[model samples]
Target: MVNQAKAHIAIPMGDPAGIGPEITVKSLAKAEIYDVCKPVVVGHTEVMKKALAVTHTNLEINEISEPEEGKYEHGTIDMINLDNLNIDHLEWGVVQAQCGRAAFQYIKKSVELALEGKVAAIATTPINKESLKAGEVPYIGHTEMLEDLTNSRDPLTMFEVRNLRIFFLTRHVSLKDAISQMTKERVFEYIGRCEEALKRLGVENPLIAVAGLNPHSGENGLFGREEVDEIKPGIEMAVEKGYRAVGPVPADSVFYQALQGKYDAVLSLYHDQGHIAAKMTDFERTISITNGLPFLRTSVDHGTAFDIAGKNIASSVSMEECIKLAAKYAPNFRS
Candidate 1:
């Protein structure tokens, strides 16, 4: 049975050449998933049927043109078939331009549904970057694509695992460029944004701790001056503006402190800083949430596993977590 009060979560099938289809089928096969939300996969029905056969899961594929037509039952999987992939020519574990284009179309459709209020939220699978480039897609990854599609400016990314939340100050840039881009002004702007993002996630008063750029937070200018020169001043400015911001805490210990509940969230100085902490804490459950968008979007932190595509061995824990998180936070998301 399905919960009529539950929100509808639109799932975008990732790269067809990878384990996305496998994971999607596996995750939806679990009856517990229907308890929280009505999930509608936005992708090719043929691809999902292939996934069902490979995984040996017995679930009926109920194709529908819109989310409203979904059965939302435990024994059935509802899908909005885009019919973009040719399963005969599709090779698992290989990058194909056609697969890339198909993946983009699925995401585009899910985003459109979310924007139109047709779905409560979107829980996305992994898309291969190489395949996307081969297809000549304009965006690099999901975040960039969502930003462009929604016309959102500087959407904030927050990773949650086991009650610990981490916000990246910088992502997808070289360590050198990341360091160079860390300015007081940027920090100040991000702190306010981070605070707002937390509030949107239902945190009434978020105490955000900013991680340091150097060891021991520059050891008070011993290891480096980035803390004294920029980070600390930025925190001070944010504090003066009535934001509950703290740190230039030592990068080594701040994540642990946040995990221990000392802070509501940690503002990581760069990509790996936050990614390493969250993934190390719990790799499978480290779900990514994109804030500052018109609708809530959650995704599996893992990538499309090309080597194990169609192998029935890929774990769907991350995908399940992504959908659950989207459902958990959808009610609070602002339009």
Candidate 2:
């Protein structure tokens, strides 16, 4: 019997020409997944069957039209089959327009279900950017697609690994542009938002550490003035607003300090600043959460490995971690 108390996590199989299907099947094959939540694959049945054959898994597929119809049990994986892909013509380990379109459709369906309250949360696989472009999809990646679909503006992103949390102030922009975007106003706004995101994740009165942009946090304006001019003022503003925010902490040491339990979360000034720290700590265990959304969403921090598709060699650790994190935080997630 499925545990009614467990949250239902919708898994959208990413690019069919990639390792999304393989890892989704491999991750769901674990018994531990059933112990925590009821997972339903929002993807094509044929693609999932091929993945099962490649991975040599004995799991059976239970196709359903809706989440409520799912058996939600172990040994039998429930899938909301979109039937969008023609598996005979689909080739793995390459970019295909058809695969890209199918991936987007899967995500759309999962988002629809989440909005309708049919599912508790979503744990997404990776989609390819080239395929998406080839397919003429309007969005470049999942974040953009989700934002447009949900009508959300500037969604917050947080990376979680081994109890360490890092929130990005800026992402998917050039380093020069990223630095240019750093200002006292921007930092102050993001700090408040990051604190609220932590509270949603069940952290009470979160202590947020702001990471410095330059070497030694500008050495007091010796290297750069971003720390002294913008970051510190932002932290002060956040603190004055009754938020427990601190530091334009030196980038070199802030991540390490946060990992050692010095703070509940670290506000990374740019993309790679926090990404490198979290990934280096544990690459496979790093799960990315999209905050400030209408529903909870988690994803594998890695990309779609087109080279290793259908090789049965892709590690499912990241997918497992994504699902586990969604289940762990779903209880406290609002809407």
* Candidate 1 regions with alpha-carbon error over 4 angstroms: 1-4
| lDDT string, candidate 1, 160-224, tens digits | 99979999989988999998888999899999999999988899889999999887888899998
Model 2: residue 6 alpha-carbon error in angstroms: 0.6
Clashing pairs in 2: none
In the order shown, what is each candidate's alpha-carbon RMSD?
A: 1.8, 1.6
Score every model by TM-score: 0.98, 0.98
